[model samples]
Target: MCTAPGSRAFLEVGGRHYRRCEHCHCTFVRPDQRPSAEAELAEYRRHHNDAQDPGYRRHLAQLATPLLQRLPPAQSGLDYGCGPGPALAGMLREAGHAVALYDPFFQPDAGALAQRYDFITCTEVAEHFHHPADEFLRLNRLLRPGGWLGLMTRFQTDDARFAQWHYRRDPTHVVFYREATLRWLAEHHGWACEIPAPNVALMYKPVL
Candidate 1:
């Protein structure tokens, strides 16, 4: 998000207040309502993500297939925010790419952050960001020029469905992005963005 001051109250769901950023149109939960590190880690650990799971692989393919199609052979990539099971990293590795994993709770490797990558995959991770501005800045710094930054997260389309939306119900999901929000991010960061699949966005950094 654009870090602009003064966001209007967007919604109130289950005692948590949501605010809309005037600059980026991105919606985020109030800081006071956000889950603590311990609570967030506990919620994440409850997920059963297996690298070998076929269904999970297929779900991840929504982002991976498009990204794989665009990547050059044997490129170096980073699976940013890869959870307890880095299935997406394994998928990328199977396609002959060198992949590094980084997750604050599960695989916190500072060395990985020091290096740049040809591509970065952030699947279902952006929503958990407490400070999206800083997170996106880190992602931009981690990618080489002309590199790809692929993301997968459910888009907030209809306000009517927001109250009952399953994606926002998760305590860990604090931020929500719309198509416009993604486009704003691309323009602000000097990247070309495209939506190749539902809930999937592919952004390419310009070669300087």
Candidate 2:
């Protein structure tokens, strides 16, 4: 959805036009310009997604560190969009939590989606959502009461800066979210939201 209410084209990246939702300040590439499934999968495969990669582990720790602290012993979680390596699942498993993995491309375990979780993580994945509102609502439904949803996408700061942002270069990165957009999500879904670190957010489902 275009951000400006009137829904005007905002920017053209590599000849692909994008739209911003002014009300929510969310930006997204037009549907017709989106990459094919094969291309997107190929792009993902290019990433160094090895779980044993020390640098990758450190980057995931940005979310895992805080999440591990909040989870009690033996809680179960799901690493939604865990990608090829699923290092975050490995990390949480090491912390004494039972973790299930789901990735549409690499680990498309349908049974994982059938299960609910005490907490769920979607690091560096939310931006790839083609239908963010629906996907987010689905994620919320997957949680148990008082469950956590940790995310690690870079937030869009402003329009002027968006044109030059490095994160937008990825063709699969469709939707962009702002801090205010996230806060609106919290208010809309009745989840308590917190941003403990840069490009990271923790949303808590109500205990009820």
TM-score of each: 0.98, 0.94
The candidate maximizing lDDT is: 1
List clashing residue pairs in candidate 1: none
Alpha-carbon lDDT, every model: 0.95, 0.87
Error of 1 at 112 (Å): 0.3
Per-prediction backbone clash count: 0, 6
Model 1 — which ten-residue stretch has the worst lDDT? Answer: 44-53
lDDT of 1 by residue, 149-170 (tens): 9999999999888889999899
Stretches of candidate 2 exceeding 4 Å from the true structure: 1-6
- Residue 175 error, candidate 1, Å: 0.2
Estimate the overall C-alpha local distance difference test score of candidate 1. 0.95
- Cα error of candidate 1 at position 147, Å: 0.5
- Against the hidden true structure, what lDDT does model 2 obtain? 0.87
